[model samples]
Target: MAARRPARAAAANGEVRTGGSGRSDRRAELLRIAAGLFATRGYKQTTVRDIADEAGILSGSLYHHFSSKEEMLDEILRDFLGRLLERFTAIEEQGRDPKQVLDQLIEHSFATIHETPEAVALYQNESGALSGQPGFAYVDQLGRKIEEIWIRALTAGQKSGVFRDDVDAGMTYRFIRDTVWCAVRWYRPRGRFRHEAVAEQYLRVLYGGLVTE
Candidate 1:
């Protein structure tokens, strides 16, 4: 079973709407279809009909669940970013050594990619353009929030002498963020290496500086 969001959040978001037959399930299924389409086709290019076709429903039926394509897009991005921020916040709050926190953050990222690959890609590809657009201001905010979590861990590590002081923490965080998140382009969950193994190797190179001891 998939994880459940806080009841209040779900209710407020229209995620769990009126008592019904299979309406809720169908709504989620449609959102998943829309997310995959938007992620692959670029949000600007996908149409409601495309999602409806994929979901085997009429375009008219899709509007019953979501008000518009942008609304579907909004909910998808919000759902993905909200969950991601929550996880990162929890990891930071755990108050482990900065390096440890960073490790968990990376692991959480890889796991998210494995589980929500489309959402990850959609945010990366579309969020830059969506920042100032109506209803998507949160996109940039969430992006910054995620980055802040990383910079905090990296800077804290540098301060404690756990990470190299020579490198700028912000730059280092960007480097790692680009490297790890960009891997979704080539990462195959069931291929060559698993996420945990990839993360371990990435950690080795990232922390150990890719130099043989």
Candidate 2:
């Protein structure tokens, strides 16, 4: 089930008028559809008409929910990155051992790719193009914040003698981040391996080098 937002009560009849509720649901559905198109077609190449066509609604109806294609893209990315940063920040603030925090971060990342592959791909594909564009600055800002979380975790682990001291924390973070996120390109949600399994296997090799002595 889609996660439920807080319920709003109707004033007049004392009945829950879910008219606004239903519209919010439909709007979310439209955003999901748009994200997939933006991920695959490239954000610039996709038109509002394309998303409206896919949703079986007229472009005018789509405009009722979103003013423009850019609006849809903006909402999709903002929600994705905003929620991600929140979760990562919470994990960081927990002050657990660095390895535990890193473990959760990696696991959450794989689960996110499995659950929201379209958003992940959209961010990955369009971030560079949208880097300096107005109204898209949060993309880079939130991205750097996330990067800082991982780098901090790695640095902490190294200082505590948990992770290897020889590895550069920033370089190691990029290596892990790229390798894990790039899986979105080929990962099948219903494929042979579940995300937890993928995460575990990757973590095994990541924490323990591929050497048998």
The top-ranked prediction according to lDDT is 2
Clash numbers, per candidate: 0, 0
lDDT tens digits, residues 1-213, model 2? Answer: 011122221121112344666677788899899999999999889998899899998889886666678777777887788889889989889867999999999999999999999999999999999999987787888899899999999999999998889979999999999999999998999999999999999999997779987
TM-score of each: 0.90, 0.90
Task: Kindly provide the TM-score of model 2 when superposed on the true structure, using C-alpha atoms.
Answer: 0.90
Model 2: ten consecutive residues of lowest lDDT: 1-10
Query: Which residue segments of model 2 deviate by more than 4 Å?
Result: 1-19
Residue ranges of candidate 1 with Cα displaced over 4 Å:
1-15
The C-alpha RMSD in Å for every predicted model, in order, reads: 3.5, 5.2
Deviation (Å) of 127 in candidate 2: 0.6
lDDT of model 2, residue 185? 97
